[model samples]
Target chain A: MSLELIRDILVATVPLLLIFPTLFAFTTWLERKALARIQNRIGPNKVGVPLTRYGGRFSLFGLGQPMADGIKMLFKENIVPRDADRLFHLLAPILALIPAMLVLCFLPIDFPWINNIQDSVKAFMLDGAVIFFFAITGLNTLAVFMAGWASRNKYSLLGGMRAIAQMVSYEIPLVLSAVIVVMMVGSLNAAEIANAQAGWNWFIFTPWGLAAFIIFFIAALAETNRSPFDLPEAESEIIAGYFTEYSGFKFALFFLGEYIAMFAISGLAVTLFLGGGAGPGVAALPWLSVIWFLVKIFALIAVMIWLRGTLPRLRVDQLMGFAWKFLLPLSILNIFIAGSALHLLAGGRLAGLDEKQPILRQLMEGANPLVVAGLWIGALLILYVAANGLNQLSRAKVRPREYKYAE
Target chain B: MSEQIAFWILSAIAVLGALVAVRKRNLIHGVFALMIFFAALSGLFLLLLAEFIAAVQILVYIGAVGILLLFAIMLTERVAGDDGRRMTSRGWFWGLVVAAAVFVVLLLPAIQQWPTPEVTQAPDPSVEELGHKLMNPYVMTLEVLALLLTAALIGAVTAAQGMRKPKEEGSPE
Candidate 1:
């Protein structure tokens, strides 16, 4: 409502608006490249103009492919199916795209861009960013459903249903993991969480913090409909899924929304787990902090790309089972761990006795570095074994039987 | 002025969307209109300084409920068209009567509670305060909501499983 607040909103939004398009563009290129690598072939080698003057290619490894794709989608004919609900069909993509775009408002790209006018003038500040982020991302499910339903295609409807189930299931774990972060930092503001993890004692370093990070990462994958959780658009099974009936720029908008959502989740992961824009003693050079933040985000995005390349799509039942049986329980446990840890860190009393008293303090002291590291390694090893066991079980379960249903 | 303008715009959209949601013949259009209604409600919540609530409304209603409704409509073959099959006998007369009664009832409240020119400042609900209230004061309620969500999950899976079985067995072709 105030001028400073308005300025803060503008300042926070501009970089996101600028960066998102580029991220979306690059992520598309990244996905193509990764998928191509998986298939052992070159991808998008001839999209951009060649720079003859410097004897170098003008493009940065098919960087301009997104632009080319966008242009092509724009020029292509927009078709409305005869059986489709005209009003709903036309409105669906816009609805989906707008909500996806609106999520950036609550995400803090970095610390408040403070400027000194009369000692202190906070340039960009947001409260309750975590809630805002989740809330906006949640709207994505609606847009997806609308697209599917409005299309009047059975495949689209099925895709939409799958998406809704996936999104709803993942959202719980996502919120629960965020609750853990909120417990650790004692704040919901994205910037505040980053500030809390200013030094090497990042949340991702702690036991509960690590749990929250993994839970959040998996939930994010499901939320974004990326592989191995991309059941919504399983091309072989669903035939482009929800977007099957869409074409041209309308289809482009849905694609853009997908990439933007991916960027948003990656940015959130960096902010929550990787200490955000915080770098080693980078407070002296504030600009470097932003660079560090971006690096972390891109790294997270690369992980998403790697996941797409390495993992197979999960079975629908398996995805749902994992969400309910594994993610939900783990996230709930993470929350309890985070809450107790924060309570100890805050030096709060255990029952009636003072937590700072000599005996109690010794008992409630911070986790030993070695113990923490050992516990982390142990947990990782257990997880690896469990994952491998599950993989083996699924393979055994799905193997073709000797008795076939042949005539 | 901006705030007032935003309020009016959102209010208008909300009213229009609600009307379309209820009156639209096509079920899909009705659902899409409901989405607009949810968006308008979220915007109004934002204008009222309940950003968290606004976000939740968008998340829960638009994201979850809207999708559920869409799926329900799409999956049911009976609700797919507007071939006069959806209209009940004497529907038009009842609809008009209901519409008139609702309009009168709504107008009566506005007429009885006429607006004053002077505006009173209300306490802004800060997110921090809300967070404390949620965890410290309403923790039990939060737990109950979590339980409710779990129940919903179980119910949905059971229902979907029931649906899946018949389809799988019946599809001999």
Candidate 2:
């Protein structure tokens, strides 16, 4: 390849490779500190930057904790189970990481450095970029399964099974919810979707968009195996799930992969629902779009961390039921609602609205905004009732646990 | 030159993966190897500029089918297959002969240097174009395929549920 081509490829990818992993390191410290603060305790306060000869005195509130953890992991002994498939055990973490890193390219973060890059090298420039993102992220389940089964441990196997089932179940709602955006924009290209939502035209502001965003967020939380839906790696249940037998750098790799996947999915959510980098001052200062993008991502990540601190991990049955029964139907319905609303308001079908609203036609020639708004309200109500009914229908009627001898 | 290199590398990976999938004795390993083949084939599709098909290949074949195979293997008695007697069938000679015959048939056009159809113009590779084609001209075919898949899914679910009567519950205890 020519030097310019090589440079273009590097310009396209190098920032993502450097930025997200660094963010991953910092996010670990942030999660711990945040979770600790939630629990009324200080976390990682001792690992600060060293200034003096004796490991420095200014312990900057554990800012150096992730670096310290990295070093510790590097020096720690690599452990492998005797009966494990050593090849798969070695491959699993790498497999887990590759897809997570690959999907990062599909996020439309417009850095100034990448502004001059050729379209061929930019992953999100593709017409089916969103679908490609889902396809790549789907491989993460196989890696988790590989780690679980390769470990040759029952708990690991259980964790793998749970991860696969949960991921496969949640992916439907996740993709379905995202389809609303693609439907709205009439393109699957991330850049196009983001551009369609320019100047506060974020899909999240619309009723169907809001519902789709909510479903997408909930499904994303499950997709990343985040808290309230972390049945796959529930420590209390399966002892860290798929990576139960992984140690040291391998374990750290899994951790890094998980955090990156969280960032990637959050990036996609921001891209699909939050108008991507379409914040103010972006036209004058193009680079500000990167800040807006990261800000949106971190905002989503903060909510994830907050939920982690608040909601307990879901039970397996509850997790499956929530996806298949609740989120799936709602997302499917949201697509139809969004589609019909689009056809009514913006699209040129002009199908049945005029005949139904003859009185409104008397007020003005084409004043159908109230009619459209009313239709949206009615649609949202149906969605609300449907959601509640599905919730009621899918709920398992198990009696509360009885404590007779406790305390 | 870059495309050639990518094509060669991806084709190599696809071939090796398929070979390993067919040859491996361990069921799980075989399934994973098949997934590798699917993934590599998707890469080849991407190389061919068929990004939609590439994504769908990974989505349907690797993400769905590979996972299904893994689940099926997990459900079996001896998933590891460590106690395997023989993987190859006793009719290996016939199998090879039939395989060779099929391969020869498939290669006939290329081997004879048959004249390929000339393109009036290069078709747009954009997924939007594909979507228009599918929804406009091929909508019936697409809908039929969707219905067929849905039927298969429902049939599988029904078979899994089986024809058993519901249990008579007397008490919550």
Candidate 3:
């Protein structure tokens, strides 16, 4: 490749490589502090610079903890069992790290922050970026299995198996929800998807979009092995699961990979439904777009942290059932609802609002809110009926418990 | 020149990876090799400017299919070790002969000294056009495929569940 092309690639990639890891470290600290506060304790208070000079006794709130942890982890002993498969044991973490980094390559961070630059400030613009993101991110399951198998430990194997099952199950709903957005926007390009929701026209305001977003977020939680669905590495059950035999830097690699993947997917969710980088003053000052993107991502991450603090871990069977019986069917039906809604609102000849406005703008403006509301209500009715029917079906299969008084 | 070089390298990798995937004795190693094959194939698709197909190729085949293969391998047999038993029966020679025949048939077009067609640059179809095509003329085919997949899923679930004896009768005891 030419030097110019190489430079362009570097300019695009360097920020992502640096920023995401830093964001991840910051998130780790944030989650600890937030979760700690929720549980009525001071978290990570002594790790950073003390703010004794500011009259109060506020420290940096353990902001430096991730950095310290990183250094300590690097120095810690790297351990591998004698009977473990040496090559795959080493290869697994590297494999896990690959897809995590790759998914970030397709995400559009801002809407042209640089002067004399193009419309969008994406790292790379691939027409099929959405699918590409999903494809690469899904490869983590293979890495998990590899790590589990290579460890030659039963806990690791169990962890790996659980990871594969959970990831594969959740991926269907994740993709299905994304497909709904694709249906609405009628493009797979991340930039195009983001741009479609420019201004205050974010998808989350609508009913189907809201449902799809909820499904997407829940599926993302499971896919990333976050709390409530983190059965793969559940501490109490399988003793750290797939990475049970990993130590020091290798374990850190897995941790880094998971957090990065979390950020990357949440970034995608923002781009799709949250009007990525679409905020006040962004239209006039485009550089503010990056800040908007960061704000959205961190907000999503904080919610995930909040979820981690609030919810108990789900049972394994319940987790799988939730993905298949609930999410899969809900997501599939949601695609139809989204399609019908789009057709009525945007595709019809009568949908145009004004003669001068663009078709999309016309559709957004001219579409009857009352009719749209009715469509969503009908969708909600169908969903409620479906859920109720499924619940009754499940209930019929169960025998009621009979209680006897002590004799 | 660079594009040609990339195409050649990717095709070579694809072929070699395919060979290794089939020839490997250990199932997990074979699966990993298959992943390489798929990756190379996707790279080839990307080279052809069929980026959507390339993404789908990687997503479905390498991601989903690889996991499915692993699950099947673990479910049916041990994760490590091989008995070195041939997967096929005594008809291996015929299978090879059939494969060679098929390969020859497939290679016949490439083997001929065909005239180079006048190169015409066509703007690559956007994903919108592709989606329109799928939902329009190909909608029937898409519906059929969906039905086929649903049927397959149901069949697999039933097979996994197996033919259990009536629980009602057993519960009476």
Highest TM-score, which number? 2
DockQ (CA atoms), all models: 0.50, 0.76, 0.72
Ranking by DockQ: 2, 3, 1
Better of 2 and 3 by TM-score: 2
* True-vs-predicted CA distance for residue B128, candidate 2, Å: 0.8
Give me the TM-scores for chain A across all models, comma-separated.
Answer: 0.83, 0.93, 0.91
Fnat of the models, one by one?
A: 0.70, 0.70, 0.93
Q: For model 1 chain A, where is the 10-residue window of minimal lDDT? A: A115-124
Query: Chain A TM-score of model 1 versus the true structure?
Result: 0.83
Give lDDT tens digits, candidate 2, residues A26-94. Answer: 999999999999999998888767555544356777888899899999888999999999999999999
Model 2 CA deviation exceeding 4 Å by range: A51-56, A347-376, A400-407, B82-84, B114-122, B162-173
TM-score of each: 0.82, 0.92, 0.89
Please give, as one word, the docking class of candidate 3: medium
- Residue A55 of model 1 has an lDDT of 26
Cα TM-score of candidate 2? 0.92
* Tens-digit per-residue lDDT, A232-350, candidate 1: 99998999889999999999888888888887887788777778777875868776876787788788888888888899898998999888777886677666655555455445544
Clashing pairs in 2: none
